[model samples]
Target chain A: MKQIEIGHGSGGRLTRDLIKNIFLKYINSEELDPLEDAAILNLRHQRTAFTTDSYVIRPLFFPGGDIGKLSVCGTVNDLVVSGAVPRYVSLGFIIEEGFSLESLEQIAKSIGEAAKDAGIRIVTGDTKVVEKNKCDGMYINTSGIGEVMRAMPLSNISDGDAIIITGTVGDHGTSIALAREEFSIEAGVQSDCAALHDLLTPLFETDGIKWMRDPTRGGLATVLVELSESLGYGVHLYEDRVPVREDVRFISDMLGYDPLYLANEGKAIVITSGESANKVLEILKRHPLGNNAALIGKVSSKCKGVRLKTRIGGERLLDMLEEDMLPRIC
Target chain B: MIKTQDIINHIRSLVPGDRKVRIMNVCGSHEHTIAFSGMRSLMPEHIELIPGPGCPVCVCPESDIIHAITLSRRADVILVTYGDMLRVPSKDGSIRAQGRNYKMITSPSEAIRIATANPEKKIVFFSIGFETTTAPTAAILETGVPDNLYILSSHRLTPTIMEVLVKDAEIGIDGFIAPGHVSAIVGSNAWNVFSEIYGIPTVVAGFAADNLMLGIAEILGQLKNGKIRTGNVYAGVVRPEGNIQAQNIMAKFFEVADVNWRGIGYIPESGLELRDEYSARDARKVFGLKEIKEEKIPGCICGKVILGKAYPTDCKLFKRACTPKSPAGPCMVSMEGSCNIWYKTN
Candidate 1:
């Protein structure tokens, strides 16, 4: 009945009508006043790392988890990668005016459950309405602030360090890509978007651990390039060591996408010394998140840039990600 | 396994310089491999791998997309394609960008079924992908489609694209890192054309960083020693002739036809079309678009990029206005489009 779909985004009557009729009834948060651009939160932290990201993933619901779970886990992973124990997160929802209230409720409940699992509070939030045609079914923007844990020297990444990946690559991005029904392949795939801090907590305390990073947006390639740019060191990654699912590898061959450049929400790369590398990996393997963790390669002071060792005893230079393989795939 | 560091040292010895030698890979899988290995930081200063138009999703032309849009809006049609084609742009708009009605699916088999289900609606599967995808499209056609079901076959053969690049004097490509899946389907015979015509060394590569690096090493070796031939670095999957069954299926349902590449004009006998037995399901024939002209997007250098004559960064709209979200050309849409690959990876 509502022809004015985007009108709900204007902070006018439709916004208020939708919130009062739908959100307020489902969520009993006293701090989430639907009108404000920013919400005031009283927290007990002096230092905070604040990050915001928009989730516009298609097919909101997937095999393992939906966009709701991903929204919370993605933010938690971000904070954890930055060496911050996540404290609290704020979610903003922009819903198409005519979308089902049931879907919204289900998403909200998921957000609540995910927050609980990560031990973070959704202290405050906002909701806006957009016309059905103007927006996808729903768009979520989540911002979180976390307190810096014991100062882990992520900026101290140097040459001759070891590179460790905590599990396989390409699951999250490939899963989303496949779920979009964009390619023709039959594979058992699921999103790897779980909170990674629990696994990372031990690594932060390890000796010679100079830097830590999560392979997200541009996947492991972006992380590798970013490290090289910052530390001014060449990296050597073992091709056979990088663990990837058989199905993902098969599909990657079919579609011509490299599993490495594919995104992983629940994976990270740690740069540390050769001595501590095995120890850190052993400790990591003990954790649930780091079960598939392996020493994929080493930090090389000899090579001045990134390069890959071929399975057939050949060598080619590896480069930074020049573009997105699966755009908006995350 | 040749350890990653040993290869790095060898490459350092090969391309010794004050600053790293930047080697741009023109394939999407290479981009992914480079990224996953974090190989950029792991290599010597004399080697830098840049991304080229390897991701097909990044470089698909807009004219084809416009054609898809036109077909998607038909009341008698339900368009189907791989996921990447949905958001790609055309002269008018994208099939999904325009909010046009069309179904996006992973399989050509699914498109065949949908077409059969909607017997009244003239279903057109927006066919795309390399040899891996062509097999499915061919399989569906060889099996058969309803009279109303048609396919606007925009599928291109990989070797033709490679031939176009290798022969291009302006491309400046010293060697080629041949596609793995395409090589698996079409075999190394297709690449033999490159060695025969242009004498450029071609390496059949795997998706792993090590495999790709080996392919690159072979290419660099060829470049250093002045050799020209096809090397199957990816012996794990690729063979000299490729998958015979897939080739048979393709040959059974379709024939080589001179189809238009969005930016690169028409390469003679480079595209696939349904044979006479399956021509009734050809969307172009059913829709009376036998005369569909390849309309070039104004001021777009996608054609030049596809030919490897121009780098994506050379285009004025490479980053500024023409992005994946608001693509001005087809090269900015398809995953394998050069511009899209550069924009996403670089």
Candidate 2:
């Protein structure tokens, strides 16, 4: 008998193998097969995107947001980035038998409020309780549906395109990490969790927008690596120009983490044409969610891996994550 | 303000284009800076930064790993070590890939907690690293340990191995960007002999991009004047006299012994073994696992790679037979190992 390892849940190479061998073979449709974070389906002369995400973050709550807010934003963002206007989301919960009723009510209240904040409805949901030994304290899953408003494609993404992010990176990761108290250091950090439908909607209507992705697991470097390999073009990031929270930077140095590899919930990594990058940045800066947006780097015709020009004066490749730097970061 | 561009300009003004300088840095973070900062883009085309065996996991011999893996398989033993050593490849398989009940720790002091939590099991703390890391482990040992705890000492001395590098002229080391952390513990004045005896200029610098370039600039200045001297440009943290208390603690608990480096083979008096008073807590002696043998991967040149004599890509197994996920050697395992750093960055 073989036991499962933590690597199986990393959402990197090991996770890829697990999904490809076990799940995709049986349940994957053409739209669902590629695993592009969400599936876009055409029905009755209407285009819509459907996505589902599970939130099982340990401690159930952290500095900024809890599992409730994460559940809504995580699913809604999946549909929002997939070229859709988020319409409705359904929630499901699995609780241990001994879980507190007060915690459950608080989670439910937060989820309801989050749905209102996103301007979406929690149209449906289900709940279940399992034995204490068989489960964590709480786990929430959300499935979302969004009506397609405009077409956003990645086929136009090529060399010379610029890569940009919404705000300071690694806040979500650093927040959860500090909450773990693994390093015995104190930092007043919080997760950047939010619904992006308002901020990203205007950008959805803009030109030069080739691709969009929320760097959830594996962080920005992994996203760049995936894009580079899939498109066969190199992704070069200006290391100094990459944004990170000052506190997160200090904590990362103390904890030996490369913030580039930390998770981000409220930020989006976007690719746009070089011709319209500045115009796009201006628009992104105007939005509240993207006030700190900056053009980090551009696509290149160099090595087929993610490259970083350091703040000091060295250049190197950024490899696809081989192992989980922070497990269950999302 | 120590501007990197001004330092680069100074370096450029000093070195003739015809004289290709092969500078070796014996620290992982330095290699990281060279790659992460694209610092090479600033250097003249003639200057090349070669990575040395400063990374402890890169030079950890395979025999110790085999022993650790064996212990990991035992029902009564819990092998505790740093995260970097988890995936290191041995003849059979890596500790992460094959072993069971292996726990990862960030520092030597954390072993006490793990040992306390697992009171019934034998907690074998796999203490493997250089002097800077060893000093902390030694200090903790002096504080005392749990009765069920043992230590597998695989510590190596940095200066002794740097001496080994100088003796091997084929390494093409023009001068050294000395490891600052180790120097901070071993003292900056300790590296003078490389300049005094081998005529190779050495500069101790911190692990910052500006610090590295400035150190290289100073070395270039020395080369231009044909001056053989050991210099310190990272005086902010590193002093002529290092942390003497740390040095004394390290010396108190460990004795110098001839030991084998993974790829570079045996180097005399370059290893640190637990002293006789601490033999009761020594895992190697207690387990009677005295005759561990080194096994080589057929075509892997991690040996040459560790010595700064060859690049990782120069090896046949770099991306094909070996990778970060499926590593075939120690160099590909550690986050700071030259192979791992080069693969991820370059």
Candidate 3:
């Protein structure tokens, strides 16, 4: 209790406590992003969205991208899914003592390159240094500000609304976990860490979009559970429809982890009117990041929590994840 | 697809409508498959699939946890266990929440690695699981262990608890979906007692959608035809005689002992302990820890829940006092536990 355990940063129960007891107590949740990814603020006559996220992954550089690129992509993706056109993003860094200057430059270059790819600018940034062992080799935080192109409120979501996800699931979590080489499991899975602005932009044009979320910390089930719980609706997801890579699924099975519960850095959950699902999916598949997109489930008035209709046609509650073993792996 | 539907229809036809038929699955993995696959919804309304004490973590006695915790409190001991045992709460606290030097592992083999890496510190593998896991732990022992490596075996026999369940009249389990993994060790012949002696039906099924349905269907087939026999639908893995080598390895290092079950009181010869030859590597003997006093969690129905006599929702503390995040007893603590599986899945 003296110092925080690894679970406090797990983005599950311990993370909730840190937020509810510390962050939410001092800062109202309303001021933050209702989705908890980024904040939505009305500036002048137009609605603007803002979001901030920190990247503290081990190794700092992974297969798909480095922490710097991830920091930028994560913040911008939050803004994008909130139906915002990401415009400007700020960067912040906390480096440990005796860290390599060359590595710092490499991370900085990765950050700049990622921002360029997402068509966002580095408007402002901050830097700090801590003693060795006090911090990891490096930690990064990125905040993005964007203009709301349209509104896709959870309030508009109703029974019969369909839930759609972009591309395969569990790549980011699986990639990072495998990179650790803990269980002697080897897989050629790459992290699906990229900006979603291009993939989600087309859907923003459609008025059928009820609400959108990026399933990051707790995967698709968490976002669905949170949205359903908030809106007092039940979700029925088809297990077969959820697209997860075979290798990822294999590793997940070997480790007793659910791919639905694993983190996905490059996936989006789109809730739209039932009739518009095919149209939205068609638009999404036309993009690079969303080629494997699918209409996975629908909002139901059946029950309060989420349920998964497994491949065998049996139904079970897909409850929100509890405390998993590791956290920063995300 | 046609085969599954035919099985489903046959199962539905065999199920008598007047009274409820409660068929219990005593394997944690089986319960997970049933819930995750939505197998329950496919069954007829009168057919109820109850989870038994198949989950090893759910039935691990609190005294073992107390013993592990006391050892974890030591400065030189590093207690290693599978993740399921971490969150179970006892009188003082759980091994994860309260222990000073405890680490979560995927298997017992990691204990060897931990022991090798830290030669100066003593490594005590707090082993807890059913036969599927126990066989592996025993195999690791046959290969030999490091000097500092010790095992705090909390493994329990699944058949013994199933016997306990049948003895309790409160839980009228009509049949059993015998744990396939356990059957792989003990064989389909091991569960013949339930069918031959107790006059109940037992089916050894794998942890798959089709396999489980076929198992349930086979049980219903027996009940409808008034037949009592031990069937093996998971023939690919389980035989009439189980994996003799793994069973032999288990017998080499351990023996059955009367042990206390969490919530459920002492069940005679229900647990496995290290034999006298392996006493040097037994942490319980090395630690000299004595008199493990068991404490009851007030208002907890975990004992009856694992016995299949009550549902998780029937517990007063369920969702209120006990949850997967903060479990008060072993039932709500393990993912395989009847309560945790029901609490999360249902």
All candidates: interface RMSD: 8.1, 2.0, 1.4
Among incorrect, acceptable, medium and high, the docking class of model 1 is incorrect
Quote each prediction's TM-score: 0.62, 0.88, 0.88
lDDT of 1 by residue, A2-107 (tens): 3335676677787687667655554444356444555567767777878888888788886567778888888888887777888778888878767776777677
- What is candidate 3's lDDT per residue for B87-157, written digit by digit as tens? 88888788877898988888778899999999999999999888888999999999988999999998899
- Predicted complexes: DockQ each: 0.10, 0.52, 0.56
Please report the TM-score between candidate 2 and the true structure: 0.88
User: Candidate 1 chain B: worst 10 consecutive residues by lDDT?
Assistant: B15-24
Off by over 4 Å in 1: A1-330, B4-63, B129-132, B219-227, B243-256, B275-278, B290-299
Worst 10 residues of 2 chain B by lDDT: B288-297
lDDT of 1 by residue, B1-346 (tens): 5876666666555553444333445566666566544556556555545554455553344556677788777676688888878877665667887735699787877887787678777777878766677898888767766776678777777776666666555555566778787788988777887666776777888887777777777766665667778888888898998999999998888889887666666678877887877667777676776445566666778767666567678898887778866788777765566566566534
User: In candidate 2, what are the lDDT values of residues B1-346, reduced to their tens digit?
Assistant: 7676778788889886787898999998788777777777778888888889868998888889888999999999999999989888888687888899899998877898889999999999999999888998998898988988899999999999999888887987899999989999998889998999898999998887888888999888898899879999889888888999998988898999999899778889999999998899999888877646787788888899889889998988887888888888788888788888777666
Residue B240 in model 2: lDDT? 86
TM-score of chain B of each: 0.87, 0.97, 0.96
lDDT of 3 by residue, A1-330 (tens): 133444544557754664455333322323342433444444553788988888888768777988978988899999998899897776667767667655665676787678778888765554565665899888888888898988777788899999999989988888888777565676788889999999898788886898999998888888888887997869999999999999989889987778898888888999999989999999999998889999999999877788888887777887776765348864
lDDT of 2 at A306: 80
Off by over 4 Å in 3: A1-46, A324-326, B1-3, B75-78, B101-109, B112-123, B146-150, B277-282, B285-287
